[model samples]
Target: MLKLENITKRYELKKKTVYAVNNVNMTFHKGEFVSILGLSGSGKTTLVSQLGGLDQPSEGRIIVNGVDTSSFKQQDWNNYRKNNIGFVFQDFHLIAHLTAKENIEIALSLSGLTPKEKSDRAEELLALMGITEQRDQLPKQLSGGQKQRVAIARALSNKPDIILADEPTGALDPDTSVQIMEILQALAENGHLVIMVTHNKYLARDYSTRIVALESGKIISNEEVRPSKQYKDDQLSTDKSSLQFFTAVKIAMNNLKIRKKSTIFSMVSLIPSMVLIFGIMNLIFNMSGYKADFKPLLGDVLGKDNLLYVTPFEDEQLESTQKTIYKEVNRLNVYNPRIEPFKNTIIEPYTDDAISDMEDIEGVDKVLRNTYFDVIIDEKPFLLMALPPKAYASYQYGVPKKHYPEDHEEGIIMSSEAAKVLLQDNHASVKHLVGTDITFNIYNYKSAAIKLPSIMEEKNVIHTKVIDIMDISTKTKLMSNYHAGYIYVSYGYAESLRERFDLDDFTLFSYSVPDPFKSVVGVEVEGGFLITGPQLVADPLRHLRIKTSLQEKYNLFQFREFDLNMRGNNYSVKHTVILNDAFNKDSLAKLKEYGHVTKSRFDAYSVESAKKTNEYINYSLLSATLIAVVVILIPTLLVCVILYVSIILRTKEIGILKSIGARNKDILNIFTMESGILALSSGIISLVVALPLIQYVRNILESEYDLQASLGSNPMDYNMLGIITAFILSVGIITMIGLLPGRKASKLQPNTLLKHE
Candidate 1:
């Protein structure tokens, strides 16, 4: 039974009050086809809406089965609509994306029925409505009569107690209207309370067992044409209504499929942001992954864990300040150490005593020193790297042992670039030139510094056989030991040359300084007095004695005005100590006291200066990563806007769902899942495209700028951590932004949304 006690639905229009449904009392029983007949705007539709629980009565009680619904909550009303009443709208109100059967199943999806049970119930209802063959067709594919039949089937799918039809045949032809009225007449005969609101008086009178006429928001007549039959009460299901998660997903996917062009456009629009985010995140990882840079090389050729890169620590001064001072000296273009007292300059060297003390440490290992100096190969300038015999024992740069120098053979290994220059053939391979002899012309600092150009002769030349050639490929390009434009030779040969030619003792002076040569070298002029002049050569032994005396007396190594640091630069000549076994943290700490030590090359020692430098680098990398995040947010905000537009477009569909018992949470779920899918798909596609792009860019940097080491020890490698982080950040940002539109959609009222254009 259903009853309305003085139900009134009022509206305030600017300054006047209008009643869509005025105070009226009515009652209806089972097996009754009640037709509320009225013209347009006579409150017949409003009365039906109140009975169906689509809109609450503004000022009265709606009693169902002797119980008042005036105090019912929103959820209770939803349950009432889902379990006690079913709606048949004039426009059919079918979701365009769903098939006829699916439209019926959607109502069942909110119930506690199993998926198979829901499917069976939907198919049975379609068969009952005589639309079984059209069950798989969408609303747009069906004719008006078939669409109305599908709508009627969906309403009957839930087996609700009351069926409310508001102008159900308003859009149908005369014959189809007769068929729909017969269906409603049958439903009333099957022990159902059927309430029909329509303006067609002829159809209403023909189908109804009782007729109620209304005018001006008030009922004018209530007449029973036939006696109401008493039928047994059928207990309706009271399960709590909810939209399943997978059902929501299906609905969202269908929506996307219907608007596939816009969905694809949205996904493509986010690709650039995704690529930028991935690339910049990788760069940040490369900048900070110093240890990982060497993992491949160390594991393949040079053993990891025990190797250490060492540089002499002169004092506690900042390394940046020291680099600045060294750069100032480099500007002078002086290559000889003696010319500017650069050997024992501001930076101190590891003395023999200090080296012996290091050897005596608790975790002492073999120490091999490397020497770097400039040499002229034939007529071309080249840098020569002299390594000790023990240092040459490892197969450096993948070169086989056949190319290594034999014991005391005085052989040299040439770089491919250097060999290309010497042979005057860029396309020729240096591998064939192995075992060939090459001549190196050493610079005579004394001869060049004393203004004697003619004396620069072949007497200073040294001949050595080429034992091997190193190709500067990207594989080993980042290692300082395998730098291009250099020659590798034994340290013993360099030591023999040093002693044979007295290379460290050659000194020079400029006339620009006070007492250019006389005060420093003590040159006596023809007047029997020491005087400053450009052309003055005293005894080599006496000049050395005076230099040593000045070094001891004033510690003049620090006081040299023109302290040129060419041959003594750390990059040119440095020592690398490799531990035979892995050492602990304490042992590494002890080694730092003797020299700058790191597990990998280019890694700074863990001192205050190095820590400060690393801090700045980390800050810069973080800023770059944040900038990437902000850049990606551009597309994320666009996704938010797109989802908002999508919500606006689906307002009617949302209202249809709500009318069929979909909760606010269900609407929110559908939108959020759509956003998540969009973001995840964009992220995956972007990463797929970005990987190859990263390698291509790295190759350009290495070939054009020689920046392999600046990026990482291995420029072609990828960081998985960076890739994962980029994906998570991009997806999370987009999904969170999408929630804004989802929340807005959830807050909308079903009545307003159903009326949305």
Candidate 2:
């Protein structure tokens, strides 16, 4: 059944020649009971390994059933081992986790037998070996002789025609050795060839039909105590196709079998992968979170129209902010307007027909009259206006400054803080101020208080009922300063005062392009001057105060340097100067433009701080995520090293498979299958624990952050793409690790290995 012809195997030592198997020549016939007798390092194990196709000669050919087994590819050799050859090691190398029955079943399963068949054959093999009663017990629970019996059962699972035993009874007592020898002799008598290598000459002489001898890694002699018979592969019941598949699976099983500890070590090495995935997912969630900011809120308030907010410059040049605003501006859609001066606060045309002409333009909602003055409130000055009450909603700070002073009148609202100062002494609160009488004095009016000097009041004063005092500083800074205080009466009240005072040189008329925030649907004003002197620009700035005052005091409606934005609808203003505030988000954007205005709120807060905050959020998240990936890289590398060492450790077994005809792909499949199983299973377990681990670590460190964190409380949204990313990265990383050993395994000299084994 097994024959070696002038087989020579050698190894190089430092300046020394060594022969592991030297010129070994031997023959074993079918049903031959043979033992190759030698001491340790006597080339006995090497010669037996060759007989089993676990090794090949460096200098001679090996024949099994008249086939030159040395010429077989890895796959062919593997097939030969699975169906034609059986091996029994001295150590009883049974898998610890599998039961005694299951240990045999593992062999049958790799032989491509169906589950039912594997179980039946496992039972049959055990029964034949007289270990049927111990089938249910694990290897650890079995005695030495019993374990050897189970191993013999496993070797018989494939129904091989020949069995090669390497010191099969080495670990057993003399009694157990005799028992094992008896079993081998019985199998040989049953027309199966059994060859063994051992140091026990008495046993070999007593049981083997033939005996061969070797010494110092060289074959010394060969003899037949009993007559040899021709051998055949008739005992193998498996077909070629079944054997091929079984060969593949058998090689695959070796990855798990021979590298058990390394597989476990490799599995436990994935902890960092688990931790990294959790941290990365968390960083993504954190980066996606955001709080409401004024810029976006202003966008909601103004719609899609491009609005530029400009106020009195502090550190920035007025023109520079204008350029900055225009730079970021999409000129085509926003129509990019710039700050320009106006000729008049009021247009003069006292006649009804002239007023009708002012009302005729398709673009001009009105060329109505307007006036500006600085009024003293809480002893501080605020921009005040005498305009039609219906048009008063255009003030920049009016939304935040809108307040109804106390004491009922025809109609009126005062800035909240301003009203507080007026109804009290030294800005003190007046509990009864809401309904109390309030007064105003004018130099050119009748109710200006008779005996004025005596009472220290003006003569032409006129007053109206105060409606309600309100806090309008919720969205703007105007009310935070005492200057927001004002005494606002209706535009009609101003008209009557002008009539009663016999006013002259005043024409309360609106001009071109007003309303700083609402740019479209308003008259066009022009700007291209570079006026330098303070006094020269002061009057224009005073006329421009309508724009500048709102620019400084409030940011209710957003603007860039020289743009206004409005959308939706505009209603006639009544009491509230903040008519846009009264509307919902949509309606507010369509706010009506006043006949005159300018940019009022750009660069209001810390632009640098906002920029810094944005940068910090983005870069911080990215850096943390990258660092985590790098940190987790250590375990991945460890797994690779572990797998590589495992492959090297099993070099001798790999050679065994190659001699039997496994392929490079077959070898790779085995290793990859082993690593792939561990990686995939560990990946699934890690992913399952990802979010919880994140939460656990977060809870563990929650006290460290200034903000509250709860692991985002969202399901991990891993899709096919993410899984594929992980698989590709893991395989790529691991394949690189497995490559060197895999190449070495692929390049194994099968003929040389067979002789050396």
Winning model by lDDT:
1
In candidate 2, what are the lDDT values of residues 1-757, reduced to their tens digit? 5667888877779988788888777766778988888878888877776666666557788876667766776556567777777777787666565688877775565456687888888888888888889988978899999999987887777778888888898999999999999999988988788989888898999899988888887767777787645545553333332323544455555556656776666667774565475556455444434211233333323432222221123323433543543443323212223311111111221333533443342332443333223223333323344544444334333443234222122444555656655645545653445554554433211111112131133433335445555554321111113223344545665555444432222111112223322211222222211111111110111221233232244422222211111110001011112222233443323222222122222233333333443454467568766775675577667766776776556665555455333456666666655556566666666666665765666555545431221221121333234444554565455545555556656676654543332
TM agreement with the true structure for every prediction: 0.59, 0.50
Q: Each candidate: what lDDT? A: 0.68, 0.52
Indicate the TM-score of model 2.
Answer: 0.50
Error of 2 at 280 (Å): 2.2
Per-prediction tally of clashes: 0, 48
Where is model 2 more than 4 Å wrong at Cα? 217-220, 228-273, 281-622, 638-757
In model 1, the clashing pairs are none
The best candidate by TM-score is 1
**C-alpha RMSD by candidate, in order:** 14.6, 18.5
Give me the overall lDDT of model 1: 0.68
